[model samples]
Target: MAAALELFGARDPDDISIDDVAAAAGASRALVYHYFSGKRELYVAALRSAAAGLERRPPPAGGAGSLDALAGALARYFDFAEEHAAGFTALLRGGGAGRCGEVGKIVEGVRGELFASLTRRLPVREPGALLRVTLGSWIAIVESAALDWLEHRDVERRALERLLVDQMVATLTAAARHDPEASHVLHNLKNDR
Candidate 1:
């Protein structure tokens, strides 16, 4: 599964055959079939496994008290992407629209965890909407950056990661400050100023 994910970031769940995965894993194709019914099921299982691994590897502690947790989480996210490029790519790129079905649910599970982590550190009252916008934008940027890094290995990963994080923080902070729920607070601060 890891090998297959490494090979194709995220193609049609049905497109990836048991034989393909077996070839990648150096296992008998029969064994692969014996374990999994088809590509969709296997892909879902792979996603679950990946999510589990990521959850087990906790992000660094200590950033929670300082609002620096966002930076730390972004750093950790980039590090994870760099180290497990294939798996991370697969997780980010896979599945279809709506997240209603099995595969979609798994994808949503992964995305939900990321959104929760990001919003937990922020003061946003409408966390759901804010998290959606923030995560969607972040994903787009990271995906583009990842592809660029793939093509041009000369670019520094740390530099790109820091830039992404900085931009995300600025955007989220501004949005939080402007949120209607915080309007009173902002108005008070403005008057004080």
Candidate 2:
């Protein structure tokens, strides 16, 4: 899997051959085929393995139910992003992730899980459209910023995380102004302040 991830992380699934994976793994091509029926199967398995390593250090002792808890979660996430630069880049913002339906679905699954996890931390139990959209936007922003940080190292990881959290709060406020339903959630966040 490590060999596959290294290769796939560097290029698209279609570009990588089973022979390449086997060579990198220091295993026979037949052995690689023995484990995975084919290249696509191996690609998906390796991608899934990379995604699984993202298991966070369980949020703060309290939970992601508060901004404080979210900061902690973001810190852990930022740390993961910093440490797994190649994997994070390839899995999240990589060029070919959206090309293949199978890989795209895998990427979407990971994204949905991330969205679900972050929302579960919110004070709002049943978020409305505006709130949901706002949060989703924030996640996208964080991903974009992480990509920039990976390439540029323009800011400290902690600073980047804090910047994302602050922007999310600002987004919540804007969402509140535009949507009555989101306003209520914003009120809850403000009350926490």
Against the true structure, whose lDDT is highest?
Answer: 2
Query: Candidate 1 lDDT, tens digit per residue, 1-193?
Result: 6776665564554456678789989999898889888666677677667766666567656544233455566667666767676666566655432242665566677667766665554445444564466556776776677656754678787777778766765555566565653343223323331
Provide the global lDDT of candidate 2 against the true structure. 0.75
Clashing pairs in 2: none
lDDT of residue 39 for candidate 2: 82
Each candidate: how many clashes? Answer: 0, 0
What is the lDDT of every predicted structure here?
Answer: 0.62, 0.75
Candidate 1, poorest ten consecutive residues by summed lDDT: 184-193
Candidate 2 off by > 4 Å:
55-57, 94-99, 190-193
* Candidate 2 Cα deviation (angstroms), residue 14: 3.9
Model 1 regions lying over 4 Å from their true place: 10-16, 65-67, 95-100, 123-154, 180-193
